[model samples]
Every structure is written in structure tokens, then in C-alpha cells.
Target chain A: MKMVRVIVSFLAMFFVNAVSAGVDDTVWKNELKTQFFADRSISETENIIAIEAPYRAEDAALVPIRITSKINQTNDKYIKKITLIVDKNPTPFAAEFNFTPLSGKADVAMRLRINSYSYVRAIAEMNDGQLIMAKKFVKASGGCSAPIGADLDAAMKRLGRMKFKLSGTAQSNEPNLAQLLISHPNITGMQMDQVTRFIRPAYYVEEVKVTFDGQPVLTAKTDIAISADPNFRFYFVPQSSGDLRAEVSDTDGNTFSQTYRVEP
Target chain B: MKCIWIVSLGLCLGLFAVQCQAKTKETLEVQKIAPGLYFHFGHHELPNRDNHGAIANIGFVVGKECVAVLDSGGNPQQGLLLKNTIEKITDVPICYVINSHVHPDHIFGNRSFKGRGVQFIGHKNLARAMQARGGFYLQRSEEQLGVKLAPKDIVLPDIEVTDSLTLDLGHRLLTVTAHGSAHTDNDLSVLDKNSQTLWLSDLLFVEHLPVIDGSLKGWLRELKALSALKVRRVVPGHGPVMGDWPAALKPQEDYLTMLLKEVRSMIRQGKFIEQAIAEVGQMATGRWALFDAFHKKNITLVFAELEWED
Candidate 1:
């Protein structure tokens, strides 16, 4: 009996070593659980939500990530809140977005600064108060420190200009997808001034509220982790032909708004 | 007829000389730019397998005790080649390897000098920057450029120069000055006291158009300070060795200044980035090489930066 037990233990040791030699299967998803879900019971389910990011980030600074709710829009199990987390960012919690029933659907896309190999999780809070999450393993590093796409004065001068495109032509009472481009510096306080040799103060857009014909769509509360000139894609139901407005406000208490006409 | 014949002969000789220089450039080696200073000029273009990542100006200052190498080439092979060239020049031990910035073309050659007991020097933020980018750069070297890189090829500096630090090569003390984000966030320039020659790595461009990867406002501000240097000659990162330096900076300055001034006006007029991308910098079209490929990125960067000013 002792000899049989010794053989089994040796075999188990060999198995552990062999498995460890390969990519150490503590997958990015598992890492996220430890990083964000200590002591909290978090539920992971498929098809409730799906998160999409590049398999490998080409430009670590500007990684595009999109999260879509798979639950039927007509169902009462709707997404009320979402928390964006990049596991390895210096500040791992990227942003949190809140929505109301007036929101057409919780399909949001934005750019993030992924500083390293991290599992980006989108935890959607349903109306029943259950949190469901979808994750993607993003193979990118060094997004937080990646230089903003431009110079100080130059990036600041073009601030507050917004452009948007509708994914599909508007139909009355149908939720349509919209992609918005907001030209804000989104400066994280970590960046240093190029000439002054001092840390540049943090200035970024804190809130973006989208409405179609004065009806609520989605209000996103963002942080510095959003890349410069923030981009967003969300769903909105157009009850009729009217103006879709994006009212953006920054940390400096500056508000910039732009309106786009959508035809039914 | 006699004058015409003389002119034709002179033109033939000039063309032949040009052809000869081009041929020699294929296996080119470093040349003496000043007393005790040697440099090799890289081609004016992007890095590729053919150039073998030698698209930046690399050189060394031979102090009496040892040699200080500035800006190793783009790959390990180029670094090895640079080492070989140094061996051929003199038998002195190499003391310091200075990286101009984090750009792959400049620091990839760092591994070739390993085991030589040399201290690698760079901007204070280099380790952080390299840590973030080293993996991707290593991967790209293999996939895109088709050049396989070992882990060691991505070298980080041990000696960080935050404000300014001077090192001795025995008799020569080279002052490595760290500048704020211009050209790149981790840019540093070296000054040789013995020769009074300022080596402005990528900070100044001569014939080729300056590429903007950092803050344009910051770059323009740095240019203003760099213009006051009273050096005898200047070594640019990707252009011919220049004599009239601060003056040589005018064309690049003009282009960047115009980009800022006009782009700001465009924004103030409520013209979007799409319009600025199409119309800005059209006047400087014929004056620069690879303008079409790199100009839009510059405009985009500048426009994005300018938008936040308000």
C-alpha cells in the first residue's frame, strides 16, 4: 500500500510539472477573478454578455473594446450598470457606466489603455440585482503610458469637437447603433509636461450623456483610462425623426455639446 | 564649344563620384566627424530587414580610458557590426552604451555589447517605457521585419540621466542631457567637450521630414532651446552630417509651426479633423520624402493635442 501511494505521488508531481511548463494555464480569466473578485461571489455566464477586443493589441495605447448584451432587448432582465476593468492597469478599474430603462440596449464600445496582459471584464448589473460578466483575454501591454496621439497645445486646441455615424439608417421605434468620436485630451495626471519637466495635471471628460429626440439613451461616466479623443458606440431607439445629442462634461466643469440629425 | 565640352566632362565626373559613393555606402563604415569622434549615418527611411535596422546615426567617442557608444543600431547584428567596427578602430574597452531614446531602431543593438562590462545609460523613465514595449517590439522584430530577436536584444539602461550626467571615457567627458518629451518621451542628447560637437540624435532633421511621435508643442519648444547651441557641427539621427545646424532647423520648424497655427485656426472655425487631415500641410508637399505616409499621423496627433487646449 505504501509503495503504491509513493508511485501515485510521483506521478502527480510529474503531471504538475508538465502542466506548469506549458503556458501556465492560470488563464487571464482566472487572474481576473483573483484581482477583482476577492471574497465576493461573482457569476460568470456565457451568452448573457460578450466582450470583444483584439486578440493581440497592435497599438497598446489605443485598444478598442466592445461589450454587447446577449439578453433579448424585450426581456426584463436588462443591464442597469457596467464596470470596465483592465486587470493590470495601474488603476485597474477603468470606468463605470450607468443606464436606465429608457436606454435601448447596453452595447457599448470604447478605447482603453491596457498596460499589460490583462483580462478586461464587463460586469453588467441586471434589474434583478444579479451581476453577470463576460471577459476577453487581451494581449496588449503599455497603454497607460503610451504617449497621447499629439502635443499639449495641439491636443487641447481641438478639444470638444464630436463626430458620429449611425451603424444603420434610422427606423421609427427601432434601436439603432451609433459610434461617437469625442475630441478631448483625456489627460491622465501621470503624464509630464514636455517642456516644463513637471507632471501634467489630470484633465479628462467625466461624463457623456446621449439622447435621441430628448429621450435617454446611455450616460457614460468615464475616467482617464479612456484614450485621448474618446470614442463610444451605443444603442438608441429613435421614437421619431429628431436630433441625437451628446452632452459631454469634463473634470474642469467645462461642458461641450453637439447634436446630430437622425431621420426616421 | 570648348566651354560646353568642359562642362560635360565636369558633370560626368560628378555623376561618377556620386555612383562611387552610393556603391561604398552598401558596406559603409563609420567615419571621423571630428577629432576623436566617429559616426555612421543611417539611411533616410524606415527600418527593414535590408537596412537591418541601421536607420539611425550611431557613433562613439574615444576617450583615453575607454569608448562611449551612442545610440546602437536597430538590431543585434547591427550592434555586433558596430562593435566590430569599434574593434577595428582601436583596441580600447567600451565603457558606456548610451541610448538616445526607446525607439527600436536606436536600442536594438544593445545586446551585441553584452559581457563587455559596459553601463547602459538612458533617460530616467527608460526602464518603465522599455518594460511596457519590450515584448511587443521583440515580437514585431520577428513577425513584421522577419528578424528574430532574443530576449537580450531588448536592453534597459542601468544608469538613468534625469537632468544631466557626464561620464568620462578616460580623457573625454560626454555630457548626456535628458530633454522633456520631444521626438519621444525619453529623448537624450550628448555633448562632447573635446570636440565641441553636439550630437542631436533625432531632435533635428536635415533633408528628411521630421516625424512627430511626441508633443508638437513640446518639440517646438525644445527646438527653440536647441537652436542656441554654439556647436561646430551637428549629427542628426537620419540625415547627412550638417554644418549650419540651428539654421538647418528652419525648414522642420516652419513645417511644424505652420501645422499648429493653421490647424488651430481650422478648429476655431469648427472644421473637423477630417478636413484638416485632407488640407493641412499641402504647401510643404514637394519638400519632404515619405510625406504622404507620415503627414496624416502628424496632423492627427497635432489636431488631437490642439483640441484639448481649450
Candidate 2:
């Protein structure tokens, strides 16, 4: 009886230990360090780049991230590219933005999926071979698990219908802000179909481009971290009284475009 | 014999610990937001890697003979616990249950009060929203919380208030104000006159950032109106009880003010949406920490609404 009791105790202890070893916070931190330096280098100079986000997110998966640059305005040169990276995402590269002077302030905002509390870094490369960066930490979790508020079929039915709004007097000297609302599911592939228990495949907004009067304003390339029903906003220098056009294409080959007339 | 006894003791202790931990009834801390009103802080727990912390709040108003509950809880079981807590304190039956909005967290526990013949109240739009998405919400709750809520558990609101309505809780007079086209079209706020307490469900997220699925202008106006009210205390949908409602109002109001002003300014400057987002970066940084997640989204929504023609 003593021998049986001892064996049972030992087995129970072993099972508890086995379960505890699976989750490692250090592993997540280490993975972030590995990806932090993958393609971008940190810079110390103030490069007129800024990222605005909520200090704490109401929803982790749908936390809005925006990146903007002022370097081009001071130098009359355009930015080559901008990257939004989340240090801890399974795929850390949230989005990459490309721009031209016609792209205006090189700013863009989109909803993203955050697996946990993590730092978000926005890096912009100027045409003059300079990289400027800004970082903000957002507190939002369970974005990957949040249920789609709308029916899958209904959400899909309205996918890719874009709306553009250019507010303020078009004739004013102030810069015009144009917003684009895109209807897309942006499935991160990590979520399971609730009914099927099958892992959904990754599909997101891979790229977006905006044009002001036929002048390129901003371009974005993203990963699976984008939330469903992604909406984007940016600034552009409206030169003439022409239509501001937006052309967006997701990874799934879905393309959408909309044009709003600028007030003279 | 000694070794066997020691082994059995260890096993018994382990079983006891398991049972203790499995007891999920947590003692909730309640605070009086108004004279006759109380708000209970819902516990925050992340049970699984994929699940987010539950942040719903429960509110109740004590009257002469009965009490009214607003927004039961996140689950039926939780609602049962809340009911038990209420029963222990008072003999008054729960006379009314009002869902401030149709969000699952705010209304999922409707079933716990159904069999008791309580009068359930909500916006006229809630029944449709629930009927459309009730099954999906149930499935997700089960998947995420490991707790299953039956379809029959949800009780449709017998009283649908449109515009505004006042409820007389006998000793305490409570006013239910409906703010259409903010947060959600069916949003409502409960105000208790005797205690001068206002239960701003989801309208005011005290310490946490406010989520705006509604009109920024409308929400801002509602906040302004509430700020002008003579209430002594306010109970937010999420966060601790608020003694100074204005202190809790700043972050959200500041955010909306900054978004509308900055985005409008950039629009006037002829900057497109992308440029405005970049240029408006960190404009309201020092005010609130949660600005990062909501700032740009606010700008996007505000810009869309402002630019829309009548």
C-alpha cells in the first residue's frame, strides 16, 4: 500500500510539471527580439515621423494604428517606404507603406490584431536614404478570438465597398484629409470557424494606394494582423479641384477603388 | 504504515486544493454610485490564451419594495451569482432588467432573470439585434469562456423604450434616456433621482478607453449633457465607480475634440486622409494612454461622417 501511494504521488507531480512547461513568456520575448532587427535599423534623429494609437485599446484585434511622416514636407522629397511592425505577432510585420510626394504626409491608419500586450514600431524611409522611427505600446488582447459582429455571409456581401470623404473647404489653404472605409473580412487564419472548429486561412489587406488628382499619395502593404472591415485614413495635398482616388487590393486578389471630388 | 499514511494525506490535500480552486464564486465588491444605486465591479479574468478579459459591469437601483437591475452580467451563471448577492442583501424581488445596449457582455445573462417574471426592458432595436446574432453570441461565449448559455436563456425585452422614458421605482425616481445614433442606435442611460446617481452604461468608460461604434458628435454631446447634470456619482460600464464624473469625462471628450479639430484642420489644409493621419500624430498624446488605439479610428470615423452630405 505504501509503494502504491508513493507511485501515485510521483505520477501526479509529473503531470503538473509537464503542463507548466508548455507556456513560456521568455520564448515570446525572444521571438520579438529576433524580428525587431530583421529588416530595419533604429535611428536617433528626429525624422518627422510619428505614430498615434490609444495607450490602451478597447479591443485588441481592432486597435487602430496610424503612422505619419513630416520629413517630406521639410525636404520636398517623398518617403520611400514605411513599415508598421508589432514585436510579438506570429507575423510581426503588420503593414508596410510606400509613398510619393503626391501621397501627401505619408500617413495611414488601419485596424490590427494584437496577440498580447506588445510594442508597435513605425519606421519610415525617406527618399534621401534616411530612416525615422516612432514607437508606441498598445494594450489590447483577444483580437484574434473576437467574434465577427455580423453574419459571415452578410459581412462578405458588403466586402470591398469603399467610401471616401474629403472634409473642409477644398479652396482653403489647409491640407485636405481624405478617409477610405473598406469592407473586408481580413481573416487572420489563426481564428477557428466557430461551427467547424477548422482554422481559417490567412487573408488580409496586403496593399493600398491613394492618389490625389492622379498624384500618388500613400501606399500600404500588410499582413494577417489587420482586423476585419478594415478602414484607412490619410492626408494628401490636394493640388487641383480633381477627384481624390483610392485603389486598394487585398492578398486574396480583391481590388476596390473610390474617387471623391475635391471642392474648388 | 507511516509512509502510506503520509501519501494518503498528500493526496487528500491535493484534492482539497483542487476543490477550493474550482469554486468560482468570487465575492464581488460593490460601491454606491448614487444614494440608492450600486455598481459591482466585475472581475477581470483571462481563462485562455485566445480569450480577452471580461470587462462588463453590473448595476442595480434599490427602491421602496423592489429593485431594478441594469445589464446583468457576461454569463447566465454570473447573473445567477449576482441575483444571489442581491437576494442576500434585500427581500425585494428584481422588478426590472434593462439592457443598456445589445452587446453580448451587457446582455448575455438575460436568462437568469427570465423565470422570475422580471420585466425586461431595452431599446426597440435590441430584439432584432439579439434575434439576428443570439446564436452566434452563445456559441462564442461557450467557445471562449467554456460556459454554455442556452438559446432559451435570452429573454426578449418586454418593454422597448424609444426616445425617452422615466421609471418610477417607488421611493426612487429613475429616468431612462435614450441617445440615438451613439455607441449604438439603442444606447440608454439610467439616472436615479433620490441618490442623484447616473448609470452611464458604456457611455462613459472611466479608467479604460471608450469604444465608439456610434457618432462621435452625438456621444460628445451626450457626455456634455451628462456632465451638466446634477448627479452626485456616476457608474460607468467598465472601470471603478466615479465620484467626479468630469474627471472621467475628460479623456473621451479631449479625444473627440482633438480628432474633430485636427482632422478638420488637415482637411482644410488640402491634406488627404493619409497625410492627415501622419501629420496629426501624437497631437493628443499626453492626455490619455489609450489614445493610440482609438485616435486614428476616431479620425477615420469622424472624417467619414463629417464629409457625408445631408
lDDT of 2 by residue, A158-249 (tens): 77777775555665333566677777767655432332223346666787777776777777776777766666777777656787888888
lDDT of 2 by residue, B1-310 (tens): 9999999999999998887764555434566665567777854333322222234788788888778998987767667767777776678778899999877677866777876658988877666556544544554454345456666656678888887788877877778887765665568898887877788888887555565655666777777777888777788776677778677677667766777677777666656544554467475565543555555555555554443312
Give stretches of model 1 more than 4 Å off.
A1-215, A219-264, B1-28
What CAPRI class is candidate 1? incorrect
Error of 2 at B237 (Å): 1.7
Count steric clashes of candidate 1.
19
Error of 1 at B176 (Å): 0.8
TM-score of each: 0.61, 0.54
In the range A1-264, model 1's lDDT, one tens digit per residue, is 769966865665566445323333254347655665565565788867889886655345667688888864544667888989876565667778776665677888887876556677898878777788888877652211243443343446677888776755677776687777898878766532221224446788899998877876788888877887898878877777889999999999999999999997
Predicted model with the maximum TM-score: 1
Model 2, position B271: C-alpha lDDT score: 62
Most accurate candidate by lDDT:
1
CA lDDT, candidate 2, residue B189? 91
TM-score of candidate 1 chain A against the true chain A? 0.80
